[model samples]
Target: MGKVTGFMEYERLEEGYAPVQTRLKHHKEFVIGLKVDDAKVQAARCMDCGTPFCNSGCPVNNIIPDFNDLVYTNQWKNAATVLHSTNNFPEFTGRICPAPCEAACVLNVNDDPVGIKSIEHAIADRAWEEGWIVPQKAALRTGRKVAVVGSGPAGLAAAQQLARAGHDVTVFEKNDRIGGLLRYGIPDFKMEKTHIDRRVAQMEAEGVTFRTGVVVGEWPKGSKITNHAKETVSAEQLKSEFDAVLLAAGSEVSRDLPVPGRDLDGVHYAMEFLPQQNKVNAGDKLKGQTLATGKNVIVIGGGDTGSDCVGTSNRHGAKSVTQFELMPMPPEQENKPLVWPYWPTKLRTSSSHDEGCSREFAIATKEFVGEKGKLTALKTVQIEFRDGKLSEVAGSEKVWPADLVLLAMGFTNPMSQLLQSFGVDADARGNAKAGVDEKTGYKTSVDKVWAAGDVRRGQSLVVWAIREGRQAARAIDLALMGCTTLPR
Candidate 1:
């Protein structure tokens, strides 16, 4: 809102990416963020609209216009302040989030939307460079302890909020290190782990204790899902030790393809494949690590996870990479008038896709063809919508050779054993059953036990997890001290 006519004068600027060849050589952030002047011009594109749908479109409800105006005015510190006030970690969202806020921008009805995400990335980075970001240590201690299981975005946000509100917050992570998916599930090229490591340091300074390699509940031995828990604490132990318990363990059970040859040696879950690469990047040695080098790769699923698989495979120097999507390809552009101010069904090509990969839609994997108990190829068929149901096209079946197959079909729910240990109820989708009302905010069926993020909502974006974490912190704070100043 710096200039009423600025939206008409400035064009939306997009963030740049490094060359594919250079980036494919290693696992690192390839996004070239906006410069100070470039961010200012982008922010200036914010219109003087009476209502900002971007505010609501964002899962964490970031103050888009206020920050935009701040950036336009060159008040970089204030922009960071406004951004951090609502969202705990702007850096994470600024880099990896699809920027649904931009989709719902007022100008997006016809014209190109303002570059809100790029502005946010600039502000967050500038804050770090200028030493504007610091630990917010509470003056008083409530002496009440909160045990949060999972060190994902949801758990981290809640722990920070609770700690800032004078509650003694301790986060328990089963992995050998913290950050959960942020550390392992996400590819480093999208967002480096330094972003998460810094936040962990800040939270530690704010009186939050993180217990890495210590699982809250027992993980099933010999499970396909990997675990690095060095120790375990029971549900009863947490109930007795802490004033409140938050079950924020993210959804970890990946959906599997139950076709023939599912037990083949080369077919693996996307989670299994992604975490190892990230761990290796962090200087951890993984014996017999999965490598795509010189092998034909086939990835299943069309979501963000699938895209990540493609990017990681390219980095692995795979011979050939092909991605499969069960649904028909979407229109390249959305019909704005019909779906105004909301996420639209349209084809989106990620930076990963641009790196190099062939994508096929309306195709389903009929079977995994293998020999000698190892993956060899895939039997697939073209499908189409008929009578509101997907049916196979006649004479469309084909077999393609594949040495490795990564299943990125997405997660079904939080691993059940962890929830069951605490007597928590699960929704039909196998996610922890919890409500987000004034009275029942993130509360599980068991008293004093709460759940949030992907554990409660099934698979979702990082921004949504942050929202639930902050809200649940408010709820826990109120229950513990009868009032809370934490933002909901």
Candidate 2:
């Protein structure tokens, strides 16, 4: 840990952001990173808390305190090593993760926690700048092949780990490019795609093959997604080709609001809207592009996806942006004493909210008001929490005009067709049926097949997906070789 008195002396210093006016012009990362000196100062805030709850709080179990101490002492290279020991992609989590570790910080019991995420971002960026991050090529090849479906965080992690374990690894992505949601679902304003590009290079160097624009299963002909691969191989064909199959396909089914006029022309899922912007940012010309210019935008279902829609709409030069959340607004502050070391209920305003958007909570949408076939406005009502239930209050109905609506309520489950094609059993929530038992590890009901991340656990953070993927890699390796050296 850093100096014992460091936490007592230092205050948290966070990364800066570009002005909204300038940043809204394009889709790019706006969070200004900390200088080395500033990052060192922030890292010094890590105290010797005897028990590090931050480690447990992090899904990847990143060696947070070790890296913090390394950064504090100016050991930049070692800091990156410590971070990489647990997390395969600190850069991704550093930028997009909500930092649950901060919520579990010892200092957070009373004061601001250590700037762990900022320190992580600095270490990763510094490692890249100094050329310390090189490919970790396995010394020996096992001649065993692994096929990982989906190129999201989980699949990438599993492929990287399996490759490093000397197993031939190949990632299959249906999209025209790799990096699944990282390249599509997430906006560039949060994390630039270059981070993913560099990692892809590193993985290639480590002997991982990427098959882009080749889908394993047949996607419906009229999918909202147009720019993807034609079906390349059947599920049985992949099983016959590879020694093992890892299903890391994310929860792709977006939950819908089945209210009146749900099929309006202007109403679209968040995935439909977000991915187009990301493609445009990547220099792809989207024919019949969905633009938010000159339209009043309304994003429903309060979550990261909704927030991202708000930010993207603002960048689209929308006339106005509004966000609606069905749940009641949380308290501005959490009661630390009661909820310490656990995620708490509190109001969190993302950088997107700061970009300019009217956020409404405790409101439920009754219907989508539209003219002809396009959405025109939304009929909503104010609600209050009572007896552990939300009830609409009388005489609180209102109408808000809008031209576009983005439904971002979050994903419900994995696609049933894909799961059924493999004959894998699904849990009640529609995720793959897998147990945490050490004996079976991350294996599915189907032999030689495994599931991890969102497909197994439902909607969760990217870091958790990485953790599951890494763990599943180790499990698959052990099952294949009767032993594994890959880190759990």
C-alpha TM-score for every candidate: 0.98, 0.98
lDDT on C-alpha atoms for all candidate structures = 0.93, 0.91
lDDT of 1 by residue, 179-260 (tens): 9888999999988999999999999999999998887765577643335556779999999999999999999999999998
Task: State candidate 1's TM-score.
Answer: 0.98
- Model 2 / residue 279 / CA error / Å: 0.4
Best by lDDT: 1
Clashing pairs in 1: none
Clashes of each: 0, 0
What C-alpha lDDT, on a 0 to 100 scale, does residue 155 get in candidate 1?
97
Error of 2 at 400 (Å): 0.8
Alpha-carbon deviation at 310 in model 1, angstroms: 0.8
